[model samples]
Target: MKIEIPYGDSSETVELADRNVEGVLYPNPVRSGDEQQVLRKAIENPINSPKLEEFLNGKKRILLIVNDATRPTPTARIMEIIYPLLKGKDFKILIATGAHRAPTEEEYDFIFGRLYQEIRDRIVVHDAKKSECISIGKTRHGTEMRLNKLVIESDAIIPIGSVEPHYFAGYTGGRKSFLPGVASYDTITANHRLAISQDAQALRLKGNPVAEEMEDAEALFLKLNIFSIMTVLDSNHKTYAAAAGNLRDSFQALIKKADEVFCVPIKRQAEIVVTVATEPTDIDLYQSQKALDNGKYALKDGGIIILVSACRSGIGSQTFLDLLGSEKSCKAVIEKLNREYKLGYHKAGKMAEIGLRSQMWAVTPLDPETIRKAHMRPFRSVSEALAEAFKEKGPDAKVIFIMDGGLTIPRLT
Candidate 1:
């Protein structure tokens, strides 16, 4: 059988024997609604809170928060829908950079789309390092809720985000735009440290300490007038569902919709798994590691998990590479991560944990040395990586191809 897996902008073809194929994991078949109608209805008829137009009634300065380029959130599309309401208001668009760097020129274009030229001056890129942050309070879990002051200064707040299965914190979007999205370095570092817990995993939120802390942090914003627009996109990035209204209500309301788009089931684990991270998530090793995290669940112990990404931007976080290289084993790497926990170390920890149980390999454009430093072997292409896996595991080895590992979570039935 021959299959083409996405890698960056292109796809890589890998051929395997009929007996060697386990199954190709793709997002479940879901009905995609009209994008405009989905956004319009969500903005008009909200969940628990009043409609968006009503929420913006008495507000003075409006602050629009959006995810960085890392997420597939259709912020520009949302902006287009709401710009008419914000026409006369004093609004500034803030990029929720979290601990990541500001978007590059091209990324800015990708983020703002056609409105870039018009709203260029109104845009404020979040700087976790230099941005002024105020303490909102502390989480019930004891993590401090210091965040960007812009959230407090602005009279009206609107956050546009997409919800999907997150390896940690259960899912991304909702309160996430507040925590790691617009949070201070210390706050983000403290919250993300909880990701080391076994309870922090995909499709779960009840006991996830990271998520709990995030919810706790957002609780402080209850006094403020907030209308959060959360969208659930199908596999094609078409808006299939959306919710608008109060913060927590809108976020929680979209969970079932998100599940419809990301959850995939398999009858059994496979000996080899190929997971590809595409486009923006494929920009670097740090972001692309998400594929490995999700694919790990479908891989047998000692099996090969090949991450296919371009990683053209190089190792995203030097701290990650340093941490992974500091220890000879993933166990040691985890020990160091727990001791000197940082914002990006959780990424390192997740990758290290997976490498502990499986053979980590990659077919990325990243330098071979860079790949090896992260405890993963580098292959020239998906075919090469698959050939290597077959050679080591044997001709009859079962393999699984995760079509969109960045967002797709493979579950065992």
Candidate 2:
């Protein structure tokens, strides 16, 4: 059988004998209707909160927080319904860049689409390092709750994002737009440290320390009228479902929908796993790591995992690359990460953890020298990587191919 996996802007196909293939994991097929219609209906009927006009009627200054370009949320489409309603009201759009670098003009244009020029003047790109952030309070975990002053001062706070399976923090959306999205570097790093905990795994929410702390941080802003508009995207990147209202309630609604769309059950683990970081995720290494983490679940211990990502933006962040380069071994990386947790560096540590358990090979645009520095074997093509893996495990090795690996969570059943 020949299967096509996402690579860079396009896709690449690989041929594997039927006897050698274990199974292919992908999201369940779902019908989302027309994109604009789905969004319109969601806005017209919000969950656990008043209608849009009722919610925004008396507010003087409204602040809209959006996930940065790294995320695949269709912000501009959501804005079409929102921007018109706040025509006369004072509102500002803040990009929740987290600790990553600010988005470029091209990225902003891509994010906003046709509306870029229309609301360009109202947009404010958040700088986690230099931005003026106000400390609200500390969480039970002792994470200093600091956020952008605009978020604190706004009469109304509306965060827009998509809910998906996150490597840690259970899932993305909900309170994430606040912590890592708009929070200070100190707060983001502190909160992200909880990722090392066992509870913080993908498709998990209950008892996840990282997620619990994020919820606690949101509680600090009880006095503020904060509403969230979260969406669920299908494998094709179209809006599958949307929920708007109280942060917790709306987020929970999206989670229920996501579970049905993204969770794939496998009969058993495979000896070799091949996965792809699709589309926007393939744009950089930082975002592409999710594919590796998710694919790990479907691989047997000591097995080889081959990941295909374009990584067109190179290493994505210097901090992540530096952290990977700093340690000589996986143990050394874990020790350094635990001793002093840095924001972007945790990704490197997580990658090292996975690399320690199983051999990892990458087919990406990243330079071979940089790939070696990160302690990963680099390959020029998917076929090249698979050839080596097959040579090591034999031609008839059980294999599994994961499409849109970053978004699909595989479970052994």
Candidate 3:
């Protein structure tokens, strides 16, 4: 069978032999058609629609923060709802990127299209690294939060992000954009630490530390009078559902859909694995760990793992590269990570150990030296890797394949 997988702006096709081996496929998350309808409905819904009268009633200026991606831009949806409401009031929109690098012109064009240049006068793209931030009061747990003064200075703040299942957060939305995207480094560190807490790891909503951390972040944003509008995209990357109006209500409704669409079952254990990293930064030793986490779950002991990525961007995070440099072996890495780093780091290190034990391979356009440092064998192409794996195994070796494993969801065939 031939399968097509996402590779940046286009798709890459791969083939598999009909040998009764298990296969995993991941469709791009953006669903354009559903996105439009959900955005339209959210705009029209009386209870959820952005209230121009209420917003402009006495407010001097409203600030909006949005996500910038190659596709599935929510700016158009936002403009449709807010345009009528902003007739006589002063308002501006900003892109909240958090610690990630800013979007480029090509990316902006892909995501915002004409809107990128059209909204120049009223839109201000925020650079988290360089922005002049002011210290916000500490959270209840004493996590110092530094936020954009412009966000705090505005009469109202609005956060917009696409909701999807997150690796550690369980799902992403609500106060996420504000806390990590718009928040200062200190705030990010504090909240990130919470992900390792027992509460965050608990699957239950009431006791989940992730949930509690989100609640704390949400309360802080709300106290500052921030309004939130989060989008939930279907498999096709279209807005299938939406939550608007106040922070909590909109997020709660969207969370329900996220749980349904994002939860996929994997029987656990495959003889072969294939993974892709879209964000080149994710291929960086630090961010690349996310890809490892997704790819390792279904991988069997001594199984072959293939990572398909073109990491020309180079490993961007110094801390991550340094950590990898210091640890000689996967076992030592895990021990050091658990002893010195937080729980999330420890968990990641453990995952890395599992991946190392497996027969791992990478096919990339990255420098040979860099790939060497990653401590994985390199293949020239996807086909070459699969061919090699087939030859290395026993005559009756079972084969399994995974595509775009980073955002993968297993389906029952």
| Highest lDDT against the true fold, candidate | 1
User: Between the candidate structures 1 and 2, which one is better when assessed by TM-score?
Assistant: 1
Which regions of candidate 1 deviate over 4 angstroms?
none
Model 2 per-residue lDDT tens digits across residues 256-347: 89988899889999889998888677768888888999999999998998888988788787787788889887778888887876778768
Tens-place lDDT digits, model 1, residues 1-413: 98988877777777777888899988787988789988999999988887788888978889999998998888889889999999888899999998998898888888889988899899998898889988878889887787788888988899899988999989988888888888888888888889988888989889888888877877887866788999998888889899998889988888998888788988999999999887667878899998889999899999999999888688889988988988888889988987887678888899988988999999888789888889999998988888788889988899999988888888888
Span of ten consecutive residues with least summed lDDT in model 3: 196-205
* Candidate 2 positional error at 59, Å: 1.7
> Compared to the true structure, candidate 3 yields what TM-score?
0.83
What TM-score number comes out for model 2?
0.97
Q: What is the RMSD of candidate 3?
A: 3.8
lDDT of every predicted structure (CA atoms): 0.87, 0.86, 0.63
TM-scores for every candidate against the unseen true structure: 0.98, 0.97, 0.83
Score residue 222 of candidate 1 by CA lDDT: 86
Error of 2 at 238 (Å): 1.0
lDDT of 3 at 2: 77
329, model 2: CA deviation in Å? Answer: 2.3
Model 3, C-alpha of 262: deviation from truth (Å) = 2.8
Considering only N, C-alpha and C atoms within 3 Å, which residue pairs clash in candidate 2? none
